[model samples]
Target: MLNSTQVSYFTLGAYFDTKQVKYVLFLILLCLYVLIVGSNVLLIMVICVKRSLHEPMYMFLCSLFVNELYGSTGLFPFLLVQILSDVHIISAPLCFLQIFCLYTYAGVEFCNLAVMSYDRYLAICHPLQYHALMSLKKVALFIAAAWITAFLIVTTTTSLSFSLPLCGNFINKVYCDNYSIVKLACSDTTVNNIYGLISTALVVFVSVGLILYTYMRILKVCFSGSKQTRQKAVSTCTPHLASLVNFSFGICFEVLQSRFNMSSTPGAVKVLLSLYYVTCQPLFNPVMYGVKLSTIRSMWKRLFWVKLK
Candidate 1:
């Protein structure tokens, strides 16, 4: 068995041709990371400080905002450094750690959206019993479950991956990933592949199923109710739907890239799609929630207006 130090490093192949525009890419990514952090932090602060916004929906939103920050931190820092460095190599241990963080982010994101959908479903479909159904304890439990479940799931996947002996260390992507690492394994990867598939299927199917069912029930109620009720539903659910769609599209691009032969695809396109969820989703979530959610927008405007005044 090779010792940890003897394990070879992986070259981040996604940066192979960006030398000419490395600074440009670095600046763009840095700005994006800053915006993600700043916008999510602003929303989180507003949600935390505003006693009036202490409902289950806002609480769930707070959990998502914090998660965006967590997810972005996993990728952006290393990416920024790689953009400037001549060698775009990462150690095996760090690669595994990154895989854990990025995958956990994706997992937790799915859980958060699913829980948020349920919160909306209860509020809209069962308004009379919303309070009892979505109590503080319940909301807290759901949020904790999202984090804890994601952590444990990714922890197991990462552990299984670490046991495999790698034949090579060339990762043809911008960042470390579970699939990429597993692809380099010299040993039998049937177990890792099987577990990864099962875990991913469970997270995806369960989350998507919950979202679709809740939204369907929500839509049914909206159509049968008064015009005011319909408008309220649209206004409140729009942000969640938008965020979900954005995240879904990113996931779709990634899955397509992984499942299909993308040899003819442009390197830039591959990089963008690969990094889409990590980079864009983090920024998109807060922007959608901050602008589309009326309560958040009004509070944000007032806070800025007061600061300027």
Candidate 2:
């Protein structure tokens, strides 16, 4: 483990030495990154050009696409380089920064998804107040809050990363992460690990809870109204629900994979799982929302035609 306080350090482990799938994995990840970025970029261009899509849902989606872009970026490039290079070298500071970027984007995106889900809740459950509640001013404030919260979480996470001392094992997953990164330090990862678990659980639980609760309330309100009202409410909430379910599944997979025993964990598998979190999951957001929403489709067509014109 290399000490975080040390001016510098060298990597100690080989890349999946016996694992033959490294090249295949690298190619697969590269393809995923391209699609994730391409899809989100297309969505952004669509919203920007379609004057009719100047609505709250599309605006929220635009924010999500931005989050997915940064989220994937924080981890994929480094992973791709390391996989292709056969060189397991990364300086401590650079590693920390990488984890910081990854965490910040992940945090912000989680909050934004909750906000989007809540917006849907309002539209379905409280039609009378939806416009006022999700007004431009309120949405702007929410966006600002999402950013502030992202920074605050990053501060806590980074402080934990910097405070830890690593010495013996420097191996980590392909996707750089706070806990895995901190484990590289020779010192005890107890503090960092515990902090990660608590922080992650709190964030995931809270955001997921709020979204679920809001939807539950929406279902209740819909049930009390007409048959048509109930069906419409379900239709309105379906996109938000589907997106939330997928997001939850990704977060759950990451939590499971990241909990390797610090003493005997395999670095190669760690890298593979980390790659899954960083690379495989982000496009899920764009797929769930961008493809399902008709308004987004119309907006895309209009935006592209306008651009060509």
Best by TM-score: 1
Best by lDDT: 1
Residues 132-250, candidate 1: write the lDDT tens digits. Answer: 99999999999999999999999999999888887777788889888877887877889998998899988888999999999999999998998988888888899899889989999
Q: All candidates' lDDT scores? A: 0.89, 0.72
TM-score, cand. 2 vs. native: 0.85
Clashes of 2: 13
Q: For model 1, state the Cα shift of residue 27 in Å.
A: 0.9
Clashes of each: 0, 13
Candidate 2, which ten residues in sequence have the lowest lDDT sum? 167-176
Q: Candidate 2: which stretches are off by over 4 Å?
A: 7-14, 17-26, 184-194, 261-272, 301-309
